[model samples]
Every structure is written in C-alpha cells, then in structure tokens.
Target: MVFYIIGAIILVGVIAYVAVNHIPKKLHWILSIILLATAGYLLFLINNSIMEPLRFNTEKQIRYTEVIKKLKVIRDAQVAHKTVTGDYTKSGEDLIKFIDTAEFAITQTRNVLVKQKRGLITVDIEKRVVDTIGHEPVRAMFAGKDYKNMLKIASNNNIKFIFSVDEIQKFGNLTEPVFEVKVDKKIVLTGLTDYLIRQELEAATGDEVRGEFISVGSLNEVSENGNWPPYYDKADKNLNKK
Candidate 1:
C-alpha cells in the first residue's frame, strides 16, 4: 500500500515536471514509454509485496496443520503407553508394537480384611485389592488412526521428531514422569524466507507459534499439550468442518 502511494506521487511529480519544462515532441514518446515501464515495475512490486507474505502464511499453516496432527497422534500414543506401563516410551517402534499387540488389563477392586503393622502394632485393617478380570486390546483404542508414522514429521520427511523422557519433581516432593517430542522450527519451515523464519523463532508470545520448536509435551513439565497457539487447533477444526 505504501509502495502504491509513493509510486503515484513520483509519477505525478514526473508528469508535472515534464509538462512544465515542455520537452520536445520526439522526446515525449520516450518519456511516455519510460513512465509506462516505471508503472509496470511498481505494480509488480505491489503484487509481490502483498502476495509474498500471504503465500508464506498459507504454506506455514499447511505445514503446521500436518505437523500438529502428527504431534497429537504421538501424544495420544504416549499417553496410552503410560496408562498401561506406568511410564512413557521413548522409542516410537516400541510404542507402535505395544499398541499393535498389547491388551489393557481390566480389573475390579474390592475391600479385603488384612493385617497391617503400624508403629510396632498389628491390627486388622480393610484394604483394597485389585484383580484382573479381563483384557481389552490396546490396538482397538487407536482404530482408524495412524501410529506407525507418529515419529515421522508430516511436513518435512528429512527430519523426524525428536522425543525424550525424564522424571521431574513436582511440589518438591512428588516425582512425575515427563516427556517431550519436538522439532526445530527451521526444519519445519525449511525453504521459507530466512528473515520470516527468524522472526518466528524470535517470537515469545502465545499469539503465535513462538520459540525454537514446534513441539508437544514437556521435559521440564508434565504437560501433554503442544506449544502452538489455539488458532492452529481452530484452523484444523475449521478445515474439518469444510
């Protein structure tokens, strides 16, 4: 928009100057051709300046959508693993295999009378006992979803997601299991304009996908949510609505 305004001002100034100076008739066509070329160049700049960012944003959303979908799949699979094994798995192949062949142990809990030792005293106490009654296939929970490629990044095949697991202290007493699966923004935004990618990297707000990674879960915390803005999820829902 600014470029259009500036171009218009410069063009008007050139035309006024030419008419005031009264250039030769032979030179009039030359000036006209030059003006026409200048106008065409300005239009090109206007188009490019307006369209380049749009193009960048469009591609960014496309890549982010696919990446978020895969990240969600990974997160669910990890959650299922933790439910069954009491901890998250770091290996993608192991997670897939577990999902394919493992069964969830369905159990029932009942109160039973048992002897408990407390402070050198033995007393009869009612305790809860859980018994496995049946089994449900783990694969059944992941029906119609893709887990085999949960480790692979959908946007860029050259770089897969990097995941790790650890234990963190919560409330300075409880040790909780933690995991994080992440990919560098550069890898996800590969082939994009360097300056724009740098801008995104430097961003530090929730308004955009700010930071060095487009990741889910956390090694420092126990969250299973992605770091992207809510609009990404809304965008996915909107696309599905269509």
Candidate 2:
C-alpha cells in the first residue's frame, strides 16, 4: 500500500510535469533539457536504492551457496567420524576440521558458551536446523539440479545435519559427565532433530521409513550415565530394525 501510494505520487508528478511542459513554448528547449535531466537523476536514485538491495541479496546468496557446499564436506566428515568413533554426531572441533577457507574465508571462531552456538556454523545468517534428507545419493537427487538459494535445498532435502555452534565442541568433551554441550542440555529432540535421526535410521535399515528420528536423547542420556549403549558394536542392527 505504501509502495502503491509512492508510485502514484511519482506518476502524478510526471503527468503534472508533462502538462506544464506544454505551457512555455519560448523556453521549451531549456525546459525539456531540465526535465530530462531531472528524470534521469530520479531514475538513478531509484535504481541505486533498488539494485543495491538486489546486489546485496545476490552476494549473500553466493555466500550461503558456499556454506552449503562446505556443509557437504562437513556431512561427509561426520559420516566418516561416525564410522570410526561409533558416534553419529560431530563435535565443534570436528566441524572446524571439515570446514575449508572457501566456506568462511577465515579460521573458525570458537565459542563454548550457549549464546554463541547459533553463530558457529552460520557466517552471516542465523543458525538453522536443516531437515534430514538421509543418506540418499546426492548425485541421484540433487546433482544436476541448480538451487537458486541454498535454503531450499537445506530445508527441503535429505541433508541430515544441524547447523549449530554446539557442533564446534570437542568430541571427547561431549560425553564428559561434568560437562554438557551447549545445545544438548534438555535431552529433547526438536522436530528437526527427530526428523534427521529418523532419516538416518531408515537409511541404515534399508527399509521403508515412516518418520524421521529414532532415539531422541540417547546420546545426551548416555553421556550423563558415563556409559555407551550396549548396542554400540551392533549400531547397524540398532539403526536398521524398528
């Protein structure tokens, strides 16, 4: 509504100028030149206001694209870390190891405090817990497709990762009884986290999936108890079956 009012005012002003342009025949050339220059200047100002925002958006989009690209590296590293350490999650240090310079163009800033968690993985935007896409082959799903914005792919697809500052914590410290990861204190799986776990479970099972997560706070609980799941050696069995 405001925009419409502003546009209407501009239109009215233009029409008024055109009407007045016809009144003075003796100074018509000077009047025409002044009107044209005024119009051009207005257009330049409008263009700067409009295009500057668009250019900023484009630059931000590019940066987010780089983030998603580096996220692939983080995901792959998490998978490998799980394979060796028997933990499906990655710590803050693990993520730093995975992130390259192209992602943020600087060494990662570490913040163990809860408030800083949102800023850890996120460069310019707020942290978002991405939807779980499971372990589907990216080549089969998203390889050839062009994503105009990284948020679409991260929000809609099978990328089983959370963009959080807690991911920057050291792995060994994650399960310490006297310590806690910033985001894991509640032992509650958010809608997004539950969704991610479910995707992972379904992929491990090689069966039809009904939901997204399996054990909601198993790790946080286990950490408190100072014991690993008895099924650690049988994670495949645990993750596969209902």
All candidates: TM-score: 0.81, 0.31
Q: For model 1, what is the C-alpha lDDT against the true structure?
A: 0.84
What local lDDT score does residue 31 receive in model 2, on the 0 to 100 scale? 60
Residue pairs with colliding backbones in model 2 are 91-167, 92-167, 92-168, 92-169, 93-168, 133-158, 133-159, 198-212, 198-213
lDDT per residue (tens digit) for residues 1-242 in model 2: 23644664586477558757665666667766766766776666667656755564454334334333434344444444443444544354543443221121122343342333354563343444434333432223233323223222332343333332122334766542111222121122223234333433344343321123212222333322111223332533665585
Q: By TM-score, how accurate is candidate 1? A: 0.81
Candidate 2 has a TM-score of 0.31
Q: Judged by TM-score, which candidate is best? A: 1
Off by over 4 Å in 2: 1-30, 45-57, 94-242
Q: How far off is residue 40 in model 2, in Å?
A: 1.3
